[model samples]
Target: MTGIGAKALQTRWFVRSPIPLFRAGLGFVFGGRLLLLQHLGRTSGQPRYVALETVERPATDRIIIASGFGAKAQWYRNLQADPHCRVWIGFDRNRAAIARTLTREESAAVLSRYRREHPKAYAQLASVIEEATELSIDDIPYVELHLS
Candidate 1:
């Protein structure tokens, strides 16, 4: 899906559905590949949640997520404002995790490895993000979450 269809799907209209289920604590159903991020709203200062696919779990306690919407994504901005956030991976929940935005070189290498490992997912995600953000996937920001 591309153009208006992809844009529509990328917007709240399509993305909002999973949020409720994720919030209801059913994110584990998606397996370890996805995570439910509970974060603070940038402006409202209210709690918000978004289900994001995990690009990689380089270590037992570390996971990486890509922000396809780049720096404009609310969740990304929120993490920047306050690195504190919570994440749910499978049946495991981390109450407080430190979020760190990855540098361009780091993200490039990470994405390169991701594409090699998950070719189909890499292409699909890149398309959705490109259509939504009107930019290349290389511009997408990646964040590392350190769980304690």
Candidate 2:
């Protein structure tokens, strides 16, 4: 599959650009669709931030996000080392939270619902993820962030 290389994904200016907005407490501009995840780096133990699309908001305090780059993603790896983190969602900034990797069954269910509700987005995301990781959407890693 034709996919973006690691460098292309990491160096994309636009991907990291919104981070400033979230840091500036203007994250609400993205509505509830995207969130800024502030997690501790696995090696450095320093704060790292990444903006990710919300695959599902199952509850007021729970959100689902996927790792399109598979387990190799730095953010996903950091969350694995330390699940504790913070979230900046619409109108909410720097809220304490915890991250959890979903089981295969849980990921399947969430992706199913996401596909149903957001067919267009799911189609595009699935394509990019599949191309990048050479894995089916169901095989991608999904993380649930629970706010405190």
Candidate 3:
């Protein structure tokens, strides 16, 4: 694992509480530039919470990739099996969302936008994506939350 990856994992387990507050603060300050709160599958059908970077496409009515640490994470795999989920943006509680796997063309366009908008994250991920060889502008699953 890269240093950043190891650090992030360490922080996730070690620095738990303050991180949520910090993420919420970032959401407020940046306005949609914060972490995504996703639910994961557990043994008893309960959910696990994970914070990830989220991209929203207002024009397309979609929330883009989580791409957690470059899409190799367990959360990504969980969503693949079950598409229904809850998303918490900012101070919101568990809001319902539907996960959708984008078409190759759709994924390419969305990923392109992501690279353009979040260059730093893009840079951090570019090498991982390339190394995975499974990475493509296409086939990156994106989730679309249903707005009430």
Highest TM-score among the candidates is held by which one? 2
Question: Each candidate's lDDT (Cα)?
Answer: 0.84, 0.88, 0.57
Shift in Å, residue 104, candidate 3: 2.0
Q: Cα RMSDs of all predictions?
A: 1.9, 2.5, 4.4
| Model 3 lDDT per residue over 1-148, tens place | 4455445544657524434664454444434554455556733456766665566556323466545344556666677677678765655545677777666676677778878888887766664444443454244556555533
**What are the runs in model 3 whose C-alpha is more than 4 Å off?**
1-11, 14-19, 22-30, 40-43, 59-61, 69-72, 118-121, 128-140
Best by lDDT: 2
lDDT of 1: 0.84
Mind sharing the TM-score for model 2?
Answer: 0.91
lDDT of 1 by residue, 39-124 (tens): 89978899888888799999978999988777888999999998899988887875579999999999999999989998987888
Better of 2 and 3 by TM-score: 2
> Model 1, 2: alpha-carbon shift in Å?
4.4
Q: Candidate 2's residue-wise lDDT over 36-122, tens digit each?
A: 999999999999999988999999999999998789889999999999999999999999999999999999999899889989877
Better of 1 and 3 by lDDT: 1
TM-score of each model, paired residue for residue: 0.88, 0.91, 0.64
